[model samples]
Target: MVNAQQYIESSFPKHIYRIFAIGKNLEGHLDLSEYPNLVEVRLGNNPLLTSLSLGPSPRPYLTAIGFRGSGITNFSFLANLPNIHMLVLVNHTQEHQAKIVRDINQVHQCKDQEIEKIKQQIIQLQQQIQSLKTCENSNRNQNSPPNLSSERNNDTS
Candidate 1:
């Protein structure tokens, strides 16, 4: 059961790629900016952790992140890691999971609505373009003079 002070006191190698601090008592923020090559991080079972801060800079190589059984409530730190593909949030209570799911669904719904609005705007622009083409065709027909050969035949008849 490593406490926050012990974990912070320990020095990690610069080239370390993966970290598994399970059951460790981590508190406040955990900055891993020193490990530029880090790829996978698993910090589950840390009930003392309230918030996690990946780093001041972006972690381009980070792909997998897990935080099961932790007391973390805010996940806004994930927005910085664009390459993350796997996220684990298991071991939480059923009620917590339900709330998280509801929040995710709301965000998904807003995104879907925004996409539909953009699609409608595109359709409206296409219709406007078609109407302009039709108007231009009508104007060209009205402005052009009648054929001279047909007029001459009419006069002779």
Candidate 2:
């Protein structure tokens, strides 16, 4: 049998600091634990992407992760990740919850201000890190590299 994991470990660039493959048609699980110098990863909006695992190698340097619309619901791998600073997990899996919150907000006008404050708190809680880059649904070029600061999703699969 072909050891896909070993093949990926040997083939992927060891010194890579980032992996931005946003809006690609990628599916299934992705484990990126070989590279020790990784600092960021942005894999948003594949919609089909189920699982993602990172660290135990790049745990110290890995700081940012953006998986806005990948459909990944489990983040247990990041429970004790100390160096991590930024995490953007919105859309799809969170859509139902957000919808419920919005509906409740509309119905409970008396608690509008309190609900607004709670929403801010929720946003702050989700964004544990500094630089956040997610969901550029307007223009996503899946043919090139990403320039997140400029709001471009040019990441290829």
Candidate 3:
């Protein structure tokens, strides 16, 4: 059961791109600050892991992260990985999954509402454009000169 401190002490290659620390019984915070080139991390089944320290360096290229059966409760660590596209949280209890789902649904609902509002604003802008076109045409017609031949015949009287 190697802990986080032991893992950090180990002189692992800095250029290693992938790490699979599944079931390692890692505890405390696992710091990956040394591995600047790390692209993927899989820490599944590490039941003792409570936190993760991604160091101060920005992992601009990191794309995937997964964790399962860990003691993690705070998800703020995800904010550090701006480019992450895939996140897997497996083996969570049913209640935990439900809570996560609920939070996701709330975010979805808020996005949906914003989308609807934008759609309505687009529709209103289209209507305003049509009204302007109508007004422009009416103004053009009102400003146009009358028939010159009709004025000539009236002058002959």
Candidate 4:
């Protein structure tokens, strides 16, 4: 039996390569284990979707994944997607809900803030270096003796 992945590539449309199921009343488990070539899977704003299975291993070609405002709690499945570049997860787990969203976005945002702080520090250091260089040149000029040619002319006069 040909798998879903094979069928998708061999089908009439030919290039159909994504799954988008958003803002629906979908509940329970949504499995996409067969389609290995899935490029993007956007399942956002579906508050009833509790469980999801995106296969055992990481999809090689999978690039984008969006799952926000859904009932899905555990995002351990996200580790199985290494190639995912774009991800949108917002309000998937509410404060009162029993659903627990692990440390994914929180860690990411913190890292971003840290990077910005480092960049600012780098800029400040560069400015200080420039200021030091200018001061060194000014001090050297002030401390230097008079030119040899001027002294010789004065002696001749």
lDDT of 2: 0.65
Tell me the tens digit of each residue's lDDT in model 1 across 1-157: 4555348437456678888887777765676666678798888989877777776676768999898988788775665565677878998878877776676566557667989999999999999999999999999999999899999999999
lDDT of model 4, residue 69: 77
Candidate 1 residue runs with Cα over 4 Å from true position = 1-26, 30-42, 52-64, 76-86, 155-157
- Error in Å for residue 16 of model 3: 1.3
**Candidate 1 local lDDT, residue 40:** 89
The TM-score of predicted model 2 comes to: 0.50
Please, what are the lDDT tens digits per residue for candidate 2 over residues 1-64? 2233343455558788887777766677778866667788887886767777775433767789
lDDT of each residue in 89-140, candidate 3, tens digit only: 8888878777755665665576679899999999999999999999999999
Error of 4 at 97 (Å): 14
**Residue pair clashes in candidate 3:** none
* Ordered list by TM-score, greatest first: 1, 3, 2, 4
Off by over 4 Å in 2: 1-12, 55-58, 92-157
Candidate 3 TM-score to native: 0.57
Candidate 1 vs candidate 3, TM-score winner? 1
lDDT of each: 0.77, 0.65, 0.77, 0.68
What TM-score would each prediction reach against the true structure? 0.60, 0.50, 0.57, 0.50
Q: How do the residues 1-157 of candidate 4 rate in per-residue lDDT, one tens digit apiece?
A: 2233333334423244787667655666666776666788777776767767778987668888887877777666766665568877676445623322335555456657989999999999999999999999999999999799999999999
Which of the two candidates, 3 or 4, achieves a greater lDDT against the reference?
3
Candidate 3: worst 10 consecutive residues by lDDT? 73-82
RMSD (Å) per prediction: 5.7, 25.8, 6.3, 8.4
